[model samples]
Target: MEERVILGTERDFEAFAAAFSRRLHAGDVVALSGPLGSGKTAFVRAVVRCLHGADQSYSPTFTFWHRYEGTPAIDHIDLFRIDDPRESAELGLEEALDGSSIVLVEWWRNAPELVAERRYEIEIEGSGNGPRVVSVRRVT
Candidate 1:
């Protein structure tokens, strides 16, 4: 099933993520896809905060991935710099998806195969300056 919502402000966006966090646990992969400046990172930050109580969120664009400590640790990954599927394999994404933690992936389109069967696929649309439309679907 799919659900959609309009986030009019930063707080609204964060609240939505925080609430959604309750449904997530270890082994869950959240595939986030959107254009640049579409608030994908912001949503990840909010979800991380909900999972661990600290923001400690950063765009993994440069490092490719970062693991944050928590009850169920979060592995934040950015696939924007990846150009090929081989690159993802080299990055050890398959190992990371081994049900060890909650993985949130930005620019997920670059490596859709990494996504697990039980996952949440979220797509955000809109410029950062205005309200954003977030579509959430549970993919099984």
Candidate 2:
């Protein structure tokens, strides 16, 4: 299923994430696509806060991957720094996607092959200080 939402405030986005998280489970992959400062990391943080009950997730743009402990683990990944898609092998992505945790990948376009077929794709469109148009789809 796919849904399009307009988020006028940061609180609205968090509310949407909280509702969306209820549909997620371990082994699920969420691909976040948006321009810089489009609230990709903020979305991840919201989802993590809802599921893991904490906001410890940071953009793994430098570290590539960060895992937060919870009932169903959260594997947050940022591939913006990857010059080669093959480098994802070193990030233990396979382990994260092995169905033990929920995986959120920002900049998944940098390494599309690393993403599983059955996954959720979220695209956020925004400019200036306007409201964001967020499109969420299940790409199974």
Candidate 3:
């Protein structure tokens, strides 16, 4: 199933994220796909804000992964810098993804093998400005 939304403002985007967070829980993996300058990190931050309320540890471009402490917890991962899928093992990615926290992966196309087989795919179109077309789909 899929839900597509056109968010005209940042507030709309955040509100959408907040509502979207309601449908998630522990062991849920979210794959965020978008080009550079897209609101991939913004979506992550908004979701984190909704889920944990005050702890939004969106991944820095250089970092491979960062975890935010919360009830269900959140694993913010950026595979953008990963040169090889083998690096996932070195990063203990599989360990963190022990079906415990809510995993959010950015630039997931860089290493699809590292993500869970069943997951949500969020695709954001339009970048560096107002109004974004967002599509959320479940792959299972």
Per-candidate TM-score against the hidden true structure:
0.91, 0.90, 0.91
Clash counts per candidate, in order, are 0, 0, 0
True-vs-predicted CA distance for residue 112, candidate 1, Å: 1.3
- Report the C-alpha displacement of residue 50, candidate 1, in angstroms: 1.3
lDDT (0 to 1) per candidate: 0.84, 0.86, 0.85
Cα error, residue 111 of model 3, in Å, equals 1.0
lDDT tens digits, residue span 110-133, model 1: 877777877899999998589889
- lDDT, candidate 1, residue 96? 62
Candidate 3 structure quality by residue, lDDT tens digits, 11-34: 898899889988998999999998
After TM-score superposition, the amount by which residue 17's alpha carbon in candidate 3 deviates from its true location, in angstroms, is 1.0
Identify the runs in model 3 with alpha carbons over 4 angstroms from their true place: 55-62
| TM-score-superior candidate, 2 or 3 | 3
Rank order (by lDDT, best first) = 2, 3, 1
Candidate 1 ranges with C-alpha deviation above 4 Å: 55-62
Model 2 TM-score relative to the real fold:
0.90
